[model samples]
Target: MKKTEEKIIRFIDAHKLIEKGERVLVAFSGGPDSVFALHFLKKFQKKYKIELAAVHFNHQLRGKEAETDEKFAKEFCGKLEVEFFSAKLNVKKLANSKKLSIEEAARKLRYQNLEKLCKQNSFSKIATAHNLSDNTETVLMNLLSGTSAAGLSGIPVVRGNIIRPVLCVTKQEILEYLEKNRIAFRIDSSNLSDDFKRNFLRNRILPLLRGKINPALDEAVYRTTSNLKSQLTVNERVVNHFINEFTRKKANGFEIRLNIAEVFGEIPGELLKVLIEKNFDYEFKHEDYAKINSLAKNHKGKKVNLGSGITVIREKELLCFQKEESSLTGEVEFPAGKKAKLCGVTVFIQKAEIEANPAKKKAYELISADELDEKFLLRTWKHGDIFKPLGFKGTKKVSDFLTDAKIPASEKKNRLVLLNRNKIIWVVGLRISDEVKITNKTKRVYKLWTI
Candidate 1:
């Protein structure tokens, strides 16, 4: 074997990228890197005792050029006698409709297709030909785009069932091997056009760097990135211990009770990013760590809202975080002659006399005080807190009302529940109670709500 092939084989063997009697799915784009991957797997199939298959996604952006690539891949697979699958996608239309960039939309669709094939065909591995150069580009992109340590760590060699056997190689090395072996592959015309960010890196920036600076910059960066990935893995394992100890669980969300920085103290920025992403799925602001680090040590009851619908509450020396999707506070409004629900709270407006004003205002709905219940109480949501809604004899819990009505978290606390002593009379913004319906005895019509 040639030196490059030996290096790739050794890397794969070291990581167990391929296993004996295993089924592997190849991400075959018919590009040089992917083609090299195909050849490498072919060379190792007998020795590894593995079954390899190819899946090609035609993004349909390059028109005939894309079609030619797909045809080439199919024919090449046939010549190799490998099982091949292909899909046609309208990536441009989907991206435009979703308001996503062309690259993102295509990537999502491609992965979805590949996963479908893998699951259905019983393939345990999906291999992509992402080489070292790609990782450097990604790291640079993340840095330029305000990336954290995880971003700086660059692309992962293996994530779940997805494996990159050629991650240690580069575009130049793959091209050299393909040339020496007389391998043929189709070019993606769009790649040559600088319409995408990756393309900008590959075509414009890489050449400039190689010409002006170090020719081996990609390898140098790759070496640094490989080390970072190892450290990140360890940090992630450690952070999960904190997550298990301190995070609170909810039916619809979670709350974190401990400040992250206090315990770990100076965790690598990359590890911090990973922990935050695991909880919130987003990177922090530039000053997030500094602020968090300070607050963890000095203050109590400070609040921070990390995205992914998660909120952090600092109170009583406990830093609590919860997903924003669920709310503990609820609302209720009792309309005169009506029932309104504020999440788990219920209210009824009955016989209240609210007078009409000369100003003729529009926002508030008023009713007579007589329509309201004599007493009302707002409390936590409980199971089987049932009430008979208007137009129905059947009763249901206040718990069911908020969920059924789809009340938003922000509005839950703000909703008012009108009540008659212990019984709920109305749920604001929803139904009024039959018991609270205004009669002609009501001399005044009460305004029940206001904007």
Candidate 2:
């Protein structure tokens, strides 16, 4: 076995990238790197006890060259008797539609196609041809563009179902192996031109750095990134502990208690940044972290819009990181003996006799059946809405009632109210109006509850 192959096998074994009898799909672009990966996997298919297949994606950017690459990839797979799948994507159109760079759009389409193929064929692992050279380039790009430690950690060896088995080898090793084995692979013309950022780095910047500074830059980067990833794994455990302890998942987004800062006083902003990233998948800029920390110390009701539909509001002693909710409109009619779903909660009304005193019960509210019409309107509580509490004589604003109940300001909009003839009869899961309370004179009663 060659040294490159042995290294890849060792990496795969260490990472548990593939299991026995697992179906592995290789992303074959007919380029040197991907072709070598497919060849290497095929060489050890029986030894690994795995089924192998290949997929080729045509980005449609190279016109005739793209079609040729697809054809070559199909023929290569045919020659090896491996299952082949191919897809042609209008990457330019996708880039324009999504307002993303051409490279980003291509990558998005490529992964989408690969995942789709995996689901259709029940593949357990999708292997991409990301080598040590790719990782080094990524780390350098992230460093140049200003990134977090996670970005500097480079590409993950195993992300969910995707694996990079050849990550242990470098581009030089792949080229040398291909040459020694008399393998033919197609070259992407786009890669030769220095039009893309990656190509510019590969052709212009990396060579100068390697010649002038470190000749072994790739290995050095690989070692550094490996260490960073290990440290990140440990940090992730701590972040997850904090998140599970202090954060609550709501319908729209996440609610993080402000007490987390006191719990983790050592650079709590970093923890909050990671927590927000985990929930919203948005990377916060350096200034955003300061803004978040500032908001944490600011007065309640203060908020910072973090773009991308994400807003962090300070509600009393809690920090609510939530997506902007659309205007709450529309109401549903709740009929007797039937349930109505309004604003994520199911409101049900059924005719029944009051089994226990309403004051002693917390699960459901008992309302006077004679006061309600044939149906009731269930809708979100709006401003200026007033309802009389069961124990109070005068009417109170629903907003004030919710505030008195200690509900977070961010959650008040989702609170539902049941109305009879435009009069508030019950605040769902909270309290019923004094007018609807069952009394000794009431003959029939209705039970209302929410799940």
Candidate 3:
């Protein structure tokens, strides 16, 4: 066996990239790198006790060339006697529609289709031909674009079900192996042009840097990224511990206690950033971290808009991170003796006889049926909305009532109210208005409950 193949096999085994009897799907682009990967996997298929399949995605940007590549991929897979799949995507159209670069669109569509194929075929793993060269280029790109430690770690060797067995070898090694075996492979014409950033780096920048600065640049970058990834793993564990310690899950979003002296440090900002990205899949910029740390030390009631519908508000001793509420603007009419779903809560109103001891049923409340109109409007509480609680003598603002109830400010905007004739009847799941409470003179009672 060739040294390249032996190294790749070792890498795969070390990472546990494949298991016996598992089905593996290879992303075949008909390029030198992918061809080498598919060939290598086919050569070792029996040894590894794995089933092999190949998939080709034509970006449709190269017209006849793209079709030719797809044809080559299919024929190549046929020669290996492997199951083949092919897809053609309008990458340009997708790029335009999504406002993303052509490369980004192609990558997104390709991976999405690959994942779908894996599910449909019950494939346990999806393998791609991302070599050492690709990893080095990725690290350089992230460095130029100003990235965090995770970004500096470059492409992951194993992300979920996707594996890169050839990642341990460089592109030159792949080409040499293919040439030695006289293997046929299609060259992507786009890769020859220096139009894209990656193409420019691969053709121009990397070669120059490798020649002038460091001939062993790829090996150096590989080592650096490996170290960064190891450190990131440790940092991530610490960040997760802090998140669990400080974060409080609320109905609207999440809260991080800032009263702790440890939370005022730099790690807390990183903890919050990770929590936001993990929960909402929204990444914040480096400047956003500084702003969050500043907000943590600021006075209460100040807020910082972190864009993408995310807001960070400083409370007395906590920092609330939540998505801006899109309150229910249109009122929903709730007829008597009916049930309706409002704001993810199922509310039911039924005619019932007032129990002798109403306090026993905490899940529901009894109200004077005569005081309600034929129908009630169910909507989010608005500013200036006020109601007199069952025990309070004077009307209190809905906002103040929520504050007094210790409801998180993030949830106050989404609080629902049951209204009769534009007057608050019940602050759903909280207090009921005194005017609507069942009394001795009440002839009919309505039972209100939410689940």
Question: How accurate locally is residue 211 in candidate 2, as Cα lDDT from 0 to 100?
Answer: 94
List the lowest-lDDT window of 10 residues for candidate 3: 260-269
Q: Regarding lDDT, does 1 or 3 come out ahead? A: 3
Model 3 lDDT, full chain set: 0.85
Q: How many backbone clashes does candidate 2 have?
A: 0
Clashing pairs in 3: none
- Report how far residue 143 has shifted in candidate 3, in Å: 2.3
lDDT of 1 at 99: 62
TM-score per candidate, chains pooled: 0.66, 0.82, 0.84
lDDT of 2 at 217: 86
Per-model C-alpha RMSD: 11.3, 3.8, 3.5
Top-lDDT candidate index: 2
Instruction: Report the lDDT tens digits of candidate 2 across residue range 391-413.
Output: 99999999999989988767777
- lDDT of each residue in 1-451, candidate 3, tens digit only: 7798889989999999989999999999999999999999999999999999999998888889989999899999999999999988889987786566788778879988999999999999999999999999999987886666777898899999999999999998999999999999999888999988888999999999999999988888999999988998999998788777878887657888875546454435457667777766355567777788888778777889885578888887788888776655556897988887777877788889978876654888889988567798888888989999988999999999998898866566778899878898999999999998777889988888989
